[model samples]
Structures are given as C-alpha cells and as structure tokens.
Target: MLEINLNPFTELQTDRLILRQVRESDAPEILFLRSDDAVMKYLDREKMESLNEARQLIQDALISVKKNEGIMWAICLRGTDFLIGTIGHWRFDKAHHRSEIGYTIRPAFWGQGLMSEAMQAVLDYGFNQLHLHSVEANVNPNNQASIKLLEKHGFVKEAHFKENYYFRGRFLDSAIYSLLKPKR
Candidate 1:
C-alpha cells in the first residue's frame, strides 16, 4: 500500500511559470476561469457565479492539500502572484497508485503553450516525486485542444465512452487518457 503526505505544500517552476499554493486572493482569477464561457465550454463542472463561490473553492483546495486528499497549484508567471489558471492531481486511487489530473486556464492565455509547461511539471511530480504508477485525464471528446495537449505529453487514449455521465442537464461523452510511469 502507498501513503502520501503534502505538508508545507510544494511549488513547481518552469522557465516562465510558477506553480504555487492557491491563496484567497486568487478568487478573482478563479471566478473568471470557472465562469468564463470559453473556459467552461467543455468543463462538466459547476460554474462559479460569485466571488464568494470562488473563495470557497480556494478554501476547498487548501483543505484538500492539508488532508492529503489531493494537491492543487495556482498557475502564475514567475515574477507574479496572480493566478491565470489552475492544475491539480485529485481523485486518488492510492491502492493502485493512480490519480486524475485536471487543469483550467483563462482563454486569454490559450495557444501560448503555458498550460503545456504546467502539465509537464505536474506530471513529473506525480510520477517521479509521488511515485504514481499512472496519471489519468478524463476529457470531453469535443475538447480537441486538450486532447492534443495530453497526447503531446504521451497520454495515450485508453478509452472513449459515449454518454457515460450526465452533466448540466445532458449526457456527455468522455475520452479517457492515461500515461504510465516510464520504465526505469
């Protein structure tokens, strides 16, 4: 069996990005990302309609970290603290050494390859630092950009389930992708 701990939090860095702990001040950015039509287009989750909702989300992220339930990072530029997006590994299956990865970026930042950078860092931490056997991504089949990004990172499509779940008053399909730890 595998046991994990995320005390004191962990921060990741890339040439142009800093992935750090989520803070209350990130509510505005969280609100935008959770509510913006473009950002929420393929997301099956609920939208944040108010700053209060966003603040609650920030709290939830913090609690999840403290409980070792999961870990989330606020994606910001290296020299800044403002969050432009968020990424995390959650829905852990410790018995199997697997976890689900999810991310959301402001539409304004799309096409810049920034999310790709963040994803790579997170995947590395998941597989190398956390000793995860695999990382999984559940994406909306219509989300081509996300599918492409996952593929570029070597997450091969493992399954495509039609109308597997219902969200926002409709049935939606899921394209499941997974990346195994490289042979060592």
Candidate 2:
C-alpha cells in the first residue's frame, strides 16, 4: 500500500507565494474574484451571484481536503498573505499514479508568473509526495496564457477535443496536456 505523509498539506511556500488550504472565511475574497466575469470566463462555474454561494464552494473544498479526495491550496503573497489564487488536484487514479490539476488567479495578479510558481509546488507534491507518475491539465483552447504556462513546464499537448465543453452558452474546445516526472 502507498502511504502519504500528509505533512505537505500543512503549508507550502515559495519565494513570492504562500500556498495554504482554503477556509470558510475565505468566502468574501473568493466572491470578490468569482464575481468578475473576466475571472470566471474560462472557468466552468458561473460567476458567484452571492456570498453564500462562495461560502458553500469554499466549505466544499475544505471538506474534500479533509476527506483526502483532493487538495485545494489558496495562493497568496508571502508577506501580506493576501488570497491571490487557488490551485487544486483531484480525480485521483491511485492505480495509475496520476491526477488532474486546475488553477485560478485573480486578474490583478495576472502576468506576474504566480501561477507558474504555484504549479511547480503542486507538481512537486504530485510527483514526490504523492508518488504520482503523471499529472494532467485541460485548458480551454482560447485561454492562450494557460496554454503557454503549461508548455513552459514541459507539459506536452496530448489531446485536442473539439467543442468538448459547452460553457457560458458557447462550445469550447479543450486542449489536454500531460506532464510526467523525469525518471530518476
């Protein structure tokens, strides 16, 4: 049986960012971000119309983390600890040693390379702590920034599905990418 230490879930830090679990109190901040169409445009979920909805979402994420079904880390600036984004991994395939990653950042924090740093930490957790062989990401084809970021991390384009996601009253193509840990 594969045993996970769980220590990494406590907190993760990079030079410019702090990655930690989401909390119920995070509802307000999340709502602020989710209320913006620009931020929710690429995401599957609709813009949060109320704080209650945001609270529910954060509560659910917290529950999932506790159940070990997945992990959602709130990304923040190191010094101020401001909630800037979130990164998550879920749909674990233990037998295959793989999982899928998803991420979102506030528009204010965009173009700062924060997602790349958070992704590196998440990838390390997947590859080293979870002992995963591969991690996959799916991005909307029109989300060029995310495509570039994934490619920067050596994730190869594995599949391109046409109009796979019917979102926001539009058909969206998805580009699937995969990254495998280099053999030691």
Candidate 3:
C-alpha cells in the first residue's frame, strides 16, 4: 500500500471550479446547503438547524483530512470563494486502495455539468495522486441524476440493496456504483 499523505496540498482547480479545504467562513453557505430540504432529501444526515452545526461539520472535516481518514473539499467557482457545493472521499480502506465518494451541489447548479467536471478532477486525484485502485458511490435508487452522473464517469452499478439504509423513520433502498483504476 502507498504511504498516503494526509496533509498533502489542499487546493484543486478545474476549468471553472476550485475545490479547497472547508473553512469557518463557509459556515453560512454550508448551513444553506445542508439546511435546504431539496438538497437534504436523499442525504442520510439530518439537516443543519444552525450555523453552529455547520461550523462543527467543517471542523470535523478538517480533522478527518488531517488524520488521513477522509478528504472533503468546498467546491467554489474559480476566482470566487463562495461555496456552491462540496465533494469528498470518505470510508477509505487503505489496505484495499479504495474509498467512497460523496458530493452535493446547489440546486441552482443542477443540470449544468459542473458536478461532472468536479468529479473528474477528484477521481483523477484519487486514482493518480492517491494511488487508489477503486472508488465507489452510494445513491438512492430513485436519484436518476446521480445515477447518470456516476455512469458518465465510467462507474458501473455493483450492487442494489433493498431498504439497506434506515433514515428518518423510513427505509431507503441504495444503489452502489464503482469505478476501477483504468488499465495502463
């Protein structure tokens, strides 16, 4: 296994977006993103009810990155610091060279192809820089947009679990998609 650097460089840039470390100043936008029912609809976590919760989340993400357990980034437009979304790889299995990817963008940005751009950049980093062998994504079975996005990035559906996730007093079915490192 590669000796991963948990504290590697913290900024990544695509043509129109920047993925950087989450900050305390991002709390307001984080609160907005996490509190919006539309955005939270498929997420397993509860909606953020206060700015303090957002702050706590940022701190937790920082610690996760520091510990090399996970890496989360605030997605923003190039030349602007306003966070429009977030993307990250968590549940890292170092021995297996795999991790689970998660992301969300503001509702306004949906259907704009921004997420595809961001996911490509992050996948490149995961496979090339981090030397990962595979990356996985979990999505609600009904989330067609997310399914399409993963397909666009060459992820194949690997599993479908009926009512595998219990969220908010209800059981939700999940689809697992995975992309392996391309053969040289």
Candidate 4:
C-alpha cells in the first residue's frame, strides 16, 4: 500500500460539475440535503437537524482530510458555487488499498445524471491519483437507483447481507458493490 494523501487536488471538474472541498458557506445546502426525508430515506445515518450540524459535518470532513483518512467534496454546477450534492470516499484503509465511496444529492437534482458525472471524477481520482486497488460502496437493498448508478460505473455486486446494519432502532439489509482497478 502507498502512503495516501487526501489533499491531492484543490478541485476536480467534469463537463457540467465541479467537485471541491466542502466549506462553511455550504451549510444551508448541506442542511437541506441531509435533512430532507426524501433525500435521507435510504441513508443509514440520522438526518441533519440544523445548520450547526451541517457546519460540524464540514469541519469534521476537513479534519479527516487533514488526517489523510478521507476526502469529501461538495458538488456544484459550473460557474456557480451553490452546493447541490456531495461525493466522497471514507473509511480509507491504506494498507488494503481500498476505500468506501459515499454520495448524496439534493432531491431536486435526482434523475438528472449529475451524480453519475460527479462520481466518475471521484472514481478517477481514487484509482488514478490515489492509486487505490478498489473502491466500494454500501447501499440499502431498496435503493435501486444507487445500485444502478454503481453498476453503470463498472462496480459489481460483491455481497448482500441481511439486516447487517442496525439503524433507527432496527436492522436493515445492505448490498456491497466494488469496482476494482483494471489490470495493468
């Protein structure tokens, strides 16, 4: 495994979107994205209840980046700074050359192909810049859209665990998908 560096680039850009570090100014959008029941429906974590929570989340993400543990980027449209979503890798295991991918988008942006565009940039960063062997994502079995997106990116289903995650006082099933680096 190689020594990982979280701050490899200040920002990443696709044709329609820009992936940049999260900032305090993005709290309102973050709050809205994380608090909306529709947006949080399939996520295992509790919804963000206030702006403070969003700010804290941004701060924590920065800290994690500084520690080389993870990288989180706010997804914004080109020529605009308003955050519409987020995509990132967390739970990085340097020795294993792998990390878990996570993402969330504003409900308004759903079905627009924006998330898929942002994901490609992040995945390229992970495989090409971070030199990771694999990238994994965990999704609720019911989130067919997310599963489809992962599959579109060449990720293959690796496992399905029944009631593997205890969330909101009950166990929930999860599916794990992984995309490995192409052979050299």
Candidate 5:
C-alpha cells in the first residue's frame, strides 16, 4: 500500500478575513451555501441535501490538500465563528509554476467585497508562498460579477469557450482568465 502524506493545514489572516482549513463543525454553514441555488448555479454540484453530505465534501477537500491534489481554504470573518465561503487552488502544475483558483461566498456576503479581500490574500500567497508564476480562474461568461472581480486582480482573459459547461440543464460559456507574476 502506498502511504499518502498530508500537508499540515494552517490558518491565515488578513485585515478582514480569516482563511483556514474547513472543520467538521463548519459543515452546517457550508451546507447552507451549498444548498443555495443562487450560489450553486455556477458550481458543479447542484445542492447538498444534508450535513453529512457537506461533511463528506469537507473530508474529501482536506484529503485532496494533503495529497497535493488541491489546496482548499475556508473563508471566515475575523473574530466570527461563521464561515462565509471557500477559496482554493486546484489544477496545479508545479513544473509549469501555475495553478487555478476557485472561490464562492455566501449570498448574504455578496456586494460586501469580502470575497475580493480573501481572494487577494490567497492570490498573494499563491504567488509568494507557493512560488507560483501564474494563476487562473475560469468563470462562466455570464457571471459578470466574477469576471469583474478577477479583472480587478490583473487576470486577463486568455480564452472564451462557448457552451462549455452544462449547468442547470443549459450549456454555458466560460471565460478563462489568467494572471502572471508582475515583472520585477
């Protein structure tokens, strides 16, 4: 049997958000967002029906991080117990020095700029701590909010795949945006 090594998850803080590993206790709150149709509209999963489902999802996310499959971070407000959302980098290509970033925030927190703050911090970590040369985010073309958010952080559209994702029955296009390390 092959022994799998796990990365020790740690907590990160910025001025307005706390980024950390998702705990079992966060399953309920996560499920709430996971169940929100508005939130899941752009996500792969339709909805989570139970806390156990969210727990299982959390477990898998952590395992993936440990196995270097991905790094998932829960986004929480400073001094608060409730998790606002999640952010992560998957599709890592270490040899190429790049990765893909994905994030989601609760509907209540939308328009508050909480997610942007979290994203900026994580993107910085991806470039500085993870030593990545670039990162990308693939957003549904119709999701103007997400596209604008990525643009604010210097991500430029590299490609536009029309009718790429099957979401809620209809096909959707996606905008592939990428950010390269600033030239020093």
Candidate 6:
C-alpha cells in the first residue's frame, strides 16, 4: 500500500535552492505569483486580488500536507530566504502511487535554470522519500519552456487533449506529461 506522511513537513535542498514549507509571511510573494499576468499566463486560474487570498492559499497548502494529501514548498535561494518560486505534488492518486507535480517561478527569475535545480530536488523527494511510483504534469500546450523543462527531466509526453478545458470564456488545450520512478 502507498504511504505518505508530511508531518513535520519535509524540507528539500538542492545545490542552489531550498524548498521549504510555505508560510503566512510568504503572502506577498505568493500573491505576486498568483496574480502576475506573466506568471499566471498559462495557469488559467483566477488572479489573487489581496494578501488575504494568498494567506488562505498558504493555509490550504498546509492543510494538504497535514492531511498527507499533498505537499507544497516555497523555493528560495540557499543564502536568502526570499521566495522566488513555488512547487508541489498534488491531486494524488494514492491507490496507484501517483501524483501530479506543479511549479512556477517569478518572471524575474526566468532563464536562470533555477527551476531545474528545484525540480530535481522535488523529484528526488517524490520518488525516494515519498516512494511515489509515477509523477505527472499537466501543462498548457503553448508553454514551451515548461515543456522543455519536463522533457529535460525525462518526463515523456503522454497525451494532448484538444479544447478540453474552458477558461476565460474560451476552451483551451492541455498536454499531459509523465515520469516513472527511476530504478535503483
């Protein structure tokens, strides 16, 4: 049987980044990520309008961890605690030892390969610490950067659904990618 326990909250580390639990104080950074047009461009989610919303998001994320349902982390530099991005594995299918991974970085930090480092840390935790059998990502078809990132990490394109989602009064396409746990 699949087992998960995020109790005590697992903090991850890479050479240049740290993945720590999201805190209430991170509301401003979270707000910027959820609200910024460039950051949320392909997310197709409602923009955050206030810090309160970001706080609520943090609470929800914490609840998920407490319940062992999922986990989210604020990505920061090793030296500075400032959050430059966030990443998580959610929408778990524990019966199959599967989960969906999601992540986003501030627009200012783009093109730095920082996300790649963070992703490696998260994947290490998901596969080794969490014992996850497979991980998946749902991405907007137009997001080539994300597509390339997934590809670079050994995730393979699994499917593409044409106009399967309705957002902002229009239907949008989705591309699914997946990776399996590497053999030891």
lDDT of 1 by residue, 1-184 (tens): 6676878799999999999999998999999999999999999888889999999989999999999889999999999998999999999899999999999998889999999999999999998888899999999999999999999999999999999989979899999999999887
Clashing pairs in 5: none
Per-residue lDDT tens digits for candidate 2, residues 7-118, read 4366788889999888877888888888888887777667888989988989888777777677888998988667888898887777777889998899888998999999
Task: Tell me the lDDT of model 2 at 77.
Answer: 92
Instruction: Write one digit per residue (lDDT tens) for candidate 3, span 7-50.
Output: 96568899999999999999999999999988888787888899
Best by lDDT: 6
Q: TM-score of predicted model 6?
A: 0.98
lDDT of 6: 0.95
How many clashing residue pairs, candidate 4? 0
Ranking by lDDT: 6, 1, 4, 3, 5, 2
Give the least accurate 10-residue stretch of model 5, judged by summed lDDT.
1-10
Better of 2 and 4 by lDDT: 4
Which window of 10 residues has the lowest lDDT sum in candidate 1? 1-10
Over the stretch 64-144, how does candidate 5's per-residue lDDT look in tens digits? 877877788889999986888999888887778888999989988999898889988888878767778889998878788
C-alpha local distance difference test of each model: 0.93, 0.84, 0.91, 0.92, 0.85, 0.95
Candidates 5 and 6, the one with greater TM-score: 6
The ten-residue window of minimal lDDT in model 3 covers 1-10
Error of 3 at 12 (Å): 0.8
TM-scores of the candidates are: 0.97, 0.92, 0.96, 0.96, 0.90, 0.98
Shift of residue 67 alpha carbon in model 5, Å: 0.9
lDDT of 6 at 8: 86
Candidate 3 stretches greater than 4 Å from native:
none
